[model samples]
Target: MRFWMVFAWLSSALLLAVAQETVLTDDALHKPITVWQRLASLAEVLDDIRKQTGVPLRCQDALREMKLAVYVQNRPAREILEQVASLFGLRWRRDDDGSYVLYLPDETRRALERAQRDDRAATERALREMLRIAREWLRLPPEARAEAMAPFAQTREYPANMPYSAYLMEEAAAQRQMTQEQRVKALVADYLSGYSPQGEPSKPKRDAFFSEEDTQGSLLHCLSEAGDAIVNRLLEGHTLGFSTRPTPDALPLPPRVLLPFWMRHAQLSDESVLQFDAASGQFTEVQPLPNPDWGGYWVRLSAWGNSLEYMVVALRVYELDGKTQKFLNKVDYQLHLPHQEYLAETETWRQWEAWATPMEDWTARLKERTPLERPKPTVNNERPLLAADALEWLAWHTGYPVISDASRYVPAWYRDSLDSPRALLTLLSNDLWLRFDPNGYLLARHKRFWTLNQFEIPERIVRPLEAKWLAWQWLSLDDYATLAAAITDEQARGFTRVRRRGSIQFWTAFDNDPLYYELPALRFWASLSAAQRQRALAGEWIPESALTLPQRKLFRAALYREFPPPEQLLRDLPDDYEVGLYVPSVFRSEGVPESRSEALKQSPDAPAFRVLQQNPVSELSVLKYKDELGRRTYTLHEVKTQVSREGVDWKKVFQEAGYEGEPAEAILKTVLDTILQFALPPRMFEQYILNQSRYADFGRHAAP
Candidate 1:
């Protein structure tokens, strides 16, 4: 394969060159210079080589051998001898018996032999020189080189009769004969003519139009005209049949032999069956058969949309010949819907049915002695939990409240922690307030503070509370009833009361605010044990408070002056000092009103009172600072509206906003116009108005 490939490549190259040359003019085919002048021109080359390598050039025979070696190694085999002849300024010709000859100059032969016998360095130098001479000789005009070494350069003969030269000559001749177009035409013609000497003749045909010769010719011609088309068709696939002659002494058909037949009916369920008359091969009746678990013998039929819609049929044939029953089987056959339609249209199925109906009829003829019964289907009914009931149950059990604040309106809840003030605050914010009975029992709750504006709380405590709530909600009714009963009875009368009055309050000393009244204060003072309360009251739990006004101011100044604490503490009181006047009138009058009035009257020479400075109040100042910051930092963009035919002119709006036609200005104007047109809700508007003040300065200096 490899040799043929190389041969094909070389042959193609040679043919291509010939074809190209044939189209060129004579001037384009420059005749190479004769060999002799080329050899003579080598003297200058030898002188140059000697200069480079310090070796004397010698011997025509040695030079010829070096040229031969180089040509053999570098050039392709066919071009080797020709290249050698060109290098030596010689031309080669084959003798009548076919042998290669090399002609060289007399002086060159002697010089080459002398160089060959020298030392290693000398031999290498000599080889280089000869190579240089060969190169120089190759450069000379073909005609000039052919004359210089005519006498000394004669053809030489090898010992044996090698056919390599003959082969090359033949190959060259053959390549010159055919162009690519000519080869294609010849190959096609030969194929069409059916000139194959290697292929055996196909079986002879009796028909007059299909004689052996004619068939072969026609097949070949068809293939030649459409070989690729035929191969492709065959590769795609074809249907063929193989017929074999049956032996004459075949055993009689088995009695009760099982022949599986598939029916391609449009509506045959798995239980559907067709009864056939074996003698007439015709279908008699159609019936549905009960599925049986008999091993190795079964039939399945299915139809579209029905459980048994698409049909697959199988059956076991039993021989019932006198007492000993045996089974005989045939290969299963499938009848597809499309194929069935074709067969039905062609009346094939009718014919097949006519022949097989008797067999099916006979097989199904047996009547069962016992009647079969089908089992009844079982039904179950159960109900799922209702969402409202579930939430109520969860709330009752876990002491948690559900709040719905999301747009989707899905209600969610978190378990309440009795010990966490934050949790209680969250509940209060959501208007889901809770209270305990006098004895610490849970009571009916109010949702005013817990559900109104509740915010998200931490998950760590919430999750446990939620779990407990869920568990309480899911507890068995019997368990809950039992607990309820126990609570109602006198046996549990000492338990915590399920109702408390003062627990829910506002705006008093026990108000639910962080400053003077909060859950921690209540839990610390009222809820803790006596010992714990005492310990906490003794300052272990209480943090030190900053000194009041005048005392603080005086201490601050004195400390700044670096006076010792003992000295500052011992300093005499100012003559006109009045501590009651220095305290805020609200704290003094409301917190210690009677005492403050009495002290003021007794101190008649006290310094006159100074009114407290009132901080400035503005619309922005009245708004919560954090709420303003949140509004500025977290955007509450209005829902975007669809474009209207008379939508606000963005360009005009941008101009009004002091933008001098910047591209994004138009977008910003459009956004603001849309926002203004949408009209926010009252609360949302307040928030937006407040935030706008904070961002107003930013908008004022922003780049257009």
Candidate 2:
């Protein structure tokens, strides 16, 4: 029997029920710290923190070897934990001990008791779906089963149309784009006689060990699910089968070789059933396997929004043998799949450091054309209306969901009528680009961002580039009981990590945009003097640095609490799935743009004074994209859009509306006659992130 056959048997036989328990610790997750780490492996970063902070950060066997990039000057440990966890949609827990006790959220663990019945009920559907597929297979007659299995037996063609990953195309796009026909030919030729390999495959045993006494070097203890291949394979093969049992060993085994327990006689085979009968492991010494041939490619994503200059540092690929539930270590079978060795640029993720809509034309249209009553944005307070409130108000009235950046919108009275979805969206877009990035975001780019071999934009075109951001918002719940319950559990013991006033919480969605209405950093920034604001733009921020942590918290709560948070435009999502905020990235930046605050020449590291990009296309239609499971990523999802048609001096509007400070006019300007901006502020985000990081990154940027 083939070795792969045994894998099916093990998967079915070992139906291990993984049960986990967690105890609550005081709150080290919120431990504020100062650190700067660029491209590094997941283990190194976690270990370094443990060594420095004396608090151990850990991961499971599968993920220990993964590499990730993180650059944060000053942030809470919870953010770090959640950021990493969300990357793979992994669950986590915060235990009573200072160490990481589990891989689920503390909030999730606490809610377990209260939501045990509910969560159990919720997960039953997936199990039932699995059963349904198994039943379908079982119902077929033996002939039909053979027919179903025929596809596996049929010879496959390798080096078919290869799907290029962002990393692989980095250099290709730079060398010069080939014509479609020429490109296809080149892609095919890249896989040299791929379908007909001429080498014997390496057969690494499951345990990579012989009998107990036959001691040799240890094999790989853990393998990182690093590239696009691993993630795609897991998601694509999520449903498990109720497979058949293994066949009997053989007809004529060793007749009767009975031996005493002390004298166990056996053939010295170089294989073991257990993982070297696992005990302690030394992961650092685990060597990398050579490479593997591609079974097929995940051609799901296209090279649209990402800047083509994304460099591929390493190219690694692995094929998951479903029958064996193991990655074929380094078997080069000539079959090809362009699974890049780096992070797959997916779900509006253009690349590691940048995102954008393709240059192709797209007119914005609502998926749901049913008439929605146009509701004017109104708040409890008598102050001017904010852009976030408008989004929340529109989302509340209409069921459309919006993803926004953390950029702050200057507050001003909206005398314009929001009688139509287009009108309302156009008004909200202001100077920013209201693009359908498959999802809508208030996005824009300044000439200053593009770079390198590709986008070889001449120095002239690149120099005057403006800085911009596409802003979505954090999810919030108000006036809706269903959404409210989703954000928090009164039964849980730990303090909520979100902003709150009585029952209502702010920025519950991981995206930071919703915080604007909750905390208008722009309004506060505008209230400051001109000289202080300009100095902040020049990269030299001037703010009171000596405020205690408690004082800063009190000030943040008192000044911004009354304002509303952004309502998650969509209906509340199911548990374990929250709206994750993707901070903007750049095509040619060194690392994460938000992490590097030293870009004073292009734009200040403030919320408001960022990028402003929009292009009016001819038509609007949703991209027909699907997930690995072939499910539509967005079901019954629709968007409503409007572009900035005219200019409005947002700063003037603020001044007239009773603000005590000056406008941040330099951040955005009327560069074109028809083009316009609302005079947003980098001053306050500079104010906002500063007030928070002032104490953290203080020693470096201290006032003279």
Candidate 3:
């Protein structure tokens, strides 16, 4: 794995070296500048502009003689260009290749006319193709073709430089084009209006619709307005496509009707999500103002304790129309520690484990009880009887070297037998008061040492999940000094908070900073050659701390991958390192419990479990297309099924997102069927006679 990673990095570097040379002029243009300067003619001023702002400016040859003299303070490249255009009675526009060009009034007008002519020509070509396809395939007469095309006949042009697939879709189906046009408008209106298809007002929007708390309405309302402002700015009057719809449905709904939706959805219907009675936290239900047209969501949270610090939150999201009650997914998150009662229960568990017979004692007792000769381990025979022994045992088994801030200690007498490797590790940790991290290390410290620095969050808990596990283990810090001590520089020390992009009321951390802090180090480390990394890890070159924090982290990670701890590498290795060969597997004398039900016992066919066992589909084919803004995305193009009783008879085509991750293949098949149920073309939907003599009509496949 390390070898391949280095190769990939070298390959990428080689590709970058061979790619097109950067244009010096283009780079100079977008660079920002602050300067105090004077300009002469437009040409000279443009030169000055380029020199100061690094913005390449080109003046029309016809306007080369135009003069402009002005003193300017610090201003951006764009602002300088605007001022120049205004002074010379000229205008500037970006070319298709992104270069900026200036033009006089008459020249600009003529350019616009030419663009319009070109647009009309493109539209006429598409229309001709559409008519020809309709005539050949749909058997549409001239009159019928005109009638079918009437809705899109009003000087409608496609987005400039359209992809071939979009052009094909436009020429193939009039209905699809009409539906897409309507869908985009509907999505925009639903996002802005906060109402469902059934004309029900969204709950969150109504509740915070007029909030004065952040001087912005509720969080959802603020978000909606921010999004609207951006869209409005981008939405200039266009000659292509249909004119914008100015209907009542597109307007924002009044507060009175909307407030009730928020009131209704805000109530917690799931007792599991709420009703957690804890001394530190109270349950709060938050209904996200529904975007009825786009989707809607609600969140339930338990915020307990003083200042409502500890929390457990559950979120539910709706897909399609909310009125239909179709939901996409739900997720639960833990953000803080459990209350006192939970901690007390855990203490009780530890005490009970201390009373149970330790595994070493049990094995010793078994040997004494039997007189027969027992098999002995071929490699290391000694068990992990001490703290150092346990560390060596872990190093050999987990394949990563262990680093410790721990001292050697006498073995504990109360280690209980556990079933799995993880369970055994947990027992050792609880019984011995030690910390084992799979990132490749173990720490043994006194009880007080663990309690003193509680704020340090483990890398695992810092993940998308509540980082709650770290909180539970550590007590809350009352002041900044204590908080600072708990956090290592390797851990995230701070977050730069920013208001949610479209909303003024809600706030979110700057995502890129945290991502940068974590990703760059790992990525750079993965890109290095293994030999170089080995040298660094072995201390053959610079000291570990000499490098930056990211580099240190990555270097340690690579070392953990290839080398075991120093103690374990010595000759005449300790017996505990090979203890795995000495350990014996024991089965319960009472025999394994039967958990399967009668139905499963009889046929071994529990429907849900059977679906999981079957690999229904593995690969999903997709088509990549660009939206109006030229952003590319992959959508489902086809779904092929494995052979079953259906004999692999069905093949479906649709444009929608496909499932990923751990969902069962059956669920994916269902989702594909749903999309195709709505997307199949009209002609393709009808039953066809496969064998006329036998009168066998093959209908479309049954709905999943």
Candidate 4:
């Protein structure tokens, strides 16, 4: 039997991502911390604190392995933390969101040193393994070796017009001539030659892994592994039968093992089976093995559900010798199916089911002459809208599911008269590149913009709240209910209970949204005059009170309360998913573009600002092109009308509508546009306009 045959029988395991529970109490920070403990590893203490506080701590793996002893009297966590840092000659800094990060002296230097050492060790181990495998393979009989290599020897052809087709064809023939043993030796020599062949003898040589290989040569090199071979078949523009099982070994048995395991242990006779050809991905009728005792196998393959990347395959093993046959075993395996091959094997409906529409179909749809509805957008006071969120909502209304994978959190607010699918799609294309595949799915790639990054987080979020800050405890039942609704989706209604110890200040946002919104609120407070700041600190400032009665109600109900206290809210909410503000920035900050942009740039450590500031080419649609002297020039297509076409100054609108403070102008503008154009509830505009102070007392006795 081939070594790979036994390799298939080996079992493997995967590690799952599980949240580590941490128990943190106010006592840890407020009460005296008394520690007269034995020797312990610094990592162990940090890990315990992490579990308790639910704050993640990251450090060098080397430092984690180091041990330390500490014995201290009653002290606060901060002081103890300082003392521990001093003990290790390390320093720590708290992030904008109050999370502490520890770093060692010359940490970068040490890290690089360790990485280099590890790489050298890894290379040596790989070299040894390759030498061992080469020796074993060389010992095998030539005929057995050739048989082992036969399956992978099949030539893969390219289209006649494709570039480098001849080169690939010639390379494939050379690969097919080499026996499996020779191939393995060549691969090993190829790898070892890198360390000492061209470079100095003292140091291992470094070079490209497959520098001499063209497309076909690369494919042959990769076929050392079964999974790679299957994937390569798909890459070669060929359909494949994916099987997950150990069939009869395709390679001939070793001369030493002349007596087969099946021959020694006769099981049963012939049974029904399926066969799959290696050369042409075709299935054949079941037939008895010429000599089952010599060990033959059968395979069957089928589509694996909705996955566009993998397929299911089953293999049945059988044995036959001298007029008798028996069944050995049956196994199943998953084969890697490339998207191209999957598309080739699938039908129109099947492809459309997974939100994958081909590019050609999208082009056709874009050019189709269909009647388009001109629907006016109305403002809705009940909910705040995010661009990605609005896109999904609109898609849902139009019978399409949009997958949200945007990098920035953009709130959209625009009024539009065009309700045609084409117009709506054109509008969305401005903010994100929507890749619609034949498989009924859409992927959203956001336009580049300077949003928030982890480092640019406001001080309020990173540090403990000041004495005047209001906590989640002050929120009402509706507020908590609304917040819970925002965090949930169709699948997860959210955790049944939120347990907070004292005034928990942990940050929940694992993305840039918080930085864009919450950070502005803190900056807004900082922007106020001393007198105004003092008044705000004295609790006289009522930002939400300035909003319309209905808007105010929704505003007060939109609190960030991911961690509720010991008491739980048992109130019932509408089963329909709620669309409301999850971040309080809408109510906290006055929209000011300059201040927002400045605040974003304040954090030199934030790479996101650079990303956001750049005008990246989000999407490109070519409408027309001309080729002149081999230099191709193309005309880019642009969407004529988008959410920004309304061009409404959101800051002025919010203020004139009696909102007290400035919202995050940048984010607010985006959200308002998205909502007005896509997420706004029908007929809500009248109520919204009536409530606006600017429109007060308008047509009191008019049509009801």
lDDT (10s digit) by residue, model 4, range 1-704: 43442233221100000100021223344445443222234566666555644566545555563433233334455445544553233556555666566666574345335433443333333333343543344344545544443443434455544433234334545755775445545554443221111111211111111122111121122222233344334333333321111122232222222111122223323213334454553333232222222221111111211111211111123244554322223121221212222222222212123222333465564453432132322344222333544454344334433333222234443224124455445545445445553333344433321111111222222222211112211221122222333332211111111111111112222212222222212222223345543443342423433334543333322222211110111122112211222211222223212221233333233111110111111111221343332333433222221123234454454444444654321111111110000011211000000000001111121111
For model 1, the stretches where C-alpha displacement exceeds 4 angstroms are 1-164, 192-222, 225-228, 231-704
For model 1 the local lDDT of residue 311 reads 11
Q: What TM-score against the true fold does each predicted structure earn? A: 0.10, 0.19, 0.17, 0.19
Q: Cα RMSDs of all predictions?
A: 54.7, 28.8, 35.1, 31.7
On the 0 to 100 scale, the lDDT of residue 585 in model 4 is 24
* Candidate 4 local Cα displacement, residue 318, angstroms: 99
Per residue, candidate 1 scores C-alpha lDDT tens digits across 1-704 of: 54554455345434543433332222312322211111112233333333433333323442321211110111122232233232233333333443323445453344334322322222233223322333333234544433432422323343333343333334445534665333333322322221111122222222211122222222232222322333233222221110011122111111221111221122233224455455543342243222211111111111100011111111222234453321111121111111111222222223223322132232222223121122211211111111122233323333332211111011212222323323323323232222222221111222211111122122222234334433322222122222223221222211111111112111111111221111111211222234533443342322112224533343233211111111122122122211111122221123221222333443223221111112111111111123321332221222122222244444444344444553311122111100000001110000000000011111222221
Candidates arranged by lDDT, highest first: 4, 3, 2, 1
Candidate 3 residue 105 C-alpha distance from true site, Å: 30
Q: Put down candidate 3 lDDT per residue, 1-704, tens digits, no spaces.
A: 54454455344433432321222235454455432221134565567676675555676885553423233333345544543443223566666666567776674345335433443333333223322332232233434533544443334468755643344345435433445434322222232232321232222232232222111112223223223332222122111110011122122332311221222332234333233335433332233333222111111111111000111111122233444232111111111111221222233233323323354443332232211122211222112233334443443334322322222122322222211233334334532343332222232332211221222232222222223212222111111112222344433212101111111111111112222122222333343345644543342323343456665554444332211221221222222211011011121111211211212232222111000011123223232455455544533322444223233332231212244422112211211000000001111110100100000012321110
Overall lDDT per candidate, in order of appearance: 0.24, 0.27, 0.29, 0.30
- Best-to-worst ranking by TM-score: 4, 2, 3, 1
